[model samples]
Target: MSLILEEISVKREHSFRSKIDVLPHIEVPWHYHPEYELIFIEKSHGTLVVGDCIDHFNDGDMIFIGPNTPHIMKNDDLFYSKESEERVIAWVVHFKEDSFGKEFFLLPEMKRIKEMLINSFKGIRIDGSTKYKIIQLLQNLHNSDYSQRIIILLQILQLIAQSEDLEYLASDSFVESFKQSSNQKLYKIYEYVSENFQQKIDLDEAAKVANMSKTAFCRFFKSKTQKTFSEFLNEMRINYAQKLLAEGKLTVAQIAYECGFNSPSYFNKQFKANTGKTPLQKKEHSY
Candidate 1:
């Protein structure tokens, strides 16, 4: 779908937007905004598409997205089933670039926070001990006095700024603004990759879905993501494989085959190249 411009301003406060969404599914379409957003998904299982990155997300996942980045949390197929009882629950806060006053952020003491803000354009995943602190602070934000709430918000930002546990979503290339027609086609390609990355997918199939010749698809995909089609596919697979490794639910060999790798040896090689860890090591670290 086309990326729609979403307005997220809070009335009377000249501050930000903070609220919770609890529903059978995430109803928002692929959208972008001028405000930075901090979100905590308390319940849900889905594929998250942010800029040119496609990845899986689940409960307790928190993310920070910068202005004008298109993103959407697409629910798993089960959520769309009428008979399924799965529900989506999330807490979100949206703030403007100048909401803290431009001068305040320019002060010497705010340098680190300012740098973190600038880096958020690529989209950041808050992880490690900082995530736990953020979770507590975010809950506090809901009940604190207005002034205290702002203080806690700054603390959360500081935590994110100072912590080393962060993951960038769109590191290499990004679509700064959506092209109505092209974004729709890109979404189809994204959806296809998300649904079928565990299977053998040829560049020809992806090219047909994107309405481009195989060679043209290579150029188009690279222009959008700075990664070849195969690279993107392998990245997606590795991401999924990381999830499986963390779960400790399958052997390395089983995970390799399940994630579409031809063999465990190749899987181990790719896993180390992409994540700096072997399957067994990741599984151990997860515990």
Candidate 2:
């Protein structure tokens, strides 16, 4: 109901904490913390909010979130019903940036892991065979001893770092949306675009949301988020299209118009570019 700091359980002898949870629903309020999180959802289907990125998640879903990122998994209403048989099943690991040694990531051998850790700032979703493997490692951790626990954890990180199936959830925006922090300016702009993505948004109108000149807003946004305004807007539209695709309620052409694309073919091309799959392919996979 409110944004709060979550205290992930950590034993005095260990620098990292791991827990496997099965819940009627994930009832935590929106929150953030000072630890990197590796999460695997074994069984659940719900809306997941990460930074400013909103999307659906299900069984076999996995993501890595960096410190200070706000997130929550809000299961669908059915999961809360007393007669429902569904459950929220997940495993999560939390460790601080310097959990190993402050200088450990500085070593040459740890370069890739170090970069992957940095990328976690945007929240990375793992898919394809990599998700399957990471889920396996997380599930088997309970059977291993402390030493193996560390080894397997590192292996998981290494595998994710090397994977091409990783998708960043917030690479384009700068909103700590859940916390309602001072980053509200960017959040406002992001919200505006998300809600109006189905219409032809004027650049001047977008800049007005940021209270800056069009050129100035472009410079400021790119400087802060490393993505141009156009790029971020397209990302938002494509994400919305993905949601529509999963709903199975609209034809591809209808969805294309609903998402503000001028034509279905152009929308399909962008969808493939953003998600690595065409609309028809995603629809087929969804069922």
Top model number, lDDT: 1
lDDT of 1: 0.82
lDDT of each residue in 1-287, candidate 1, tens digit only: 44578877686853777788899988788778889999999999888877656667989899999887777888889999999899888989998878878688899998999999988877899888999999899888887766887898899999999999999986444434233234666667776776577778988999999899998988877776667888777887887787778778899999999888888899899889988988898999999
Predicted structure 1, TM vs. truth: 0.77
TM-score on alpha carbons, each prediction: 0.77, 0.70
Candidate 2 lDDT score at position 157: 88
lDDT of 2 by residue, 109-129 (tens): 989999999878778999999
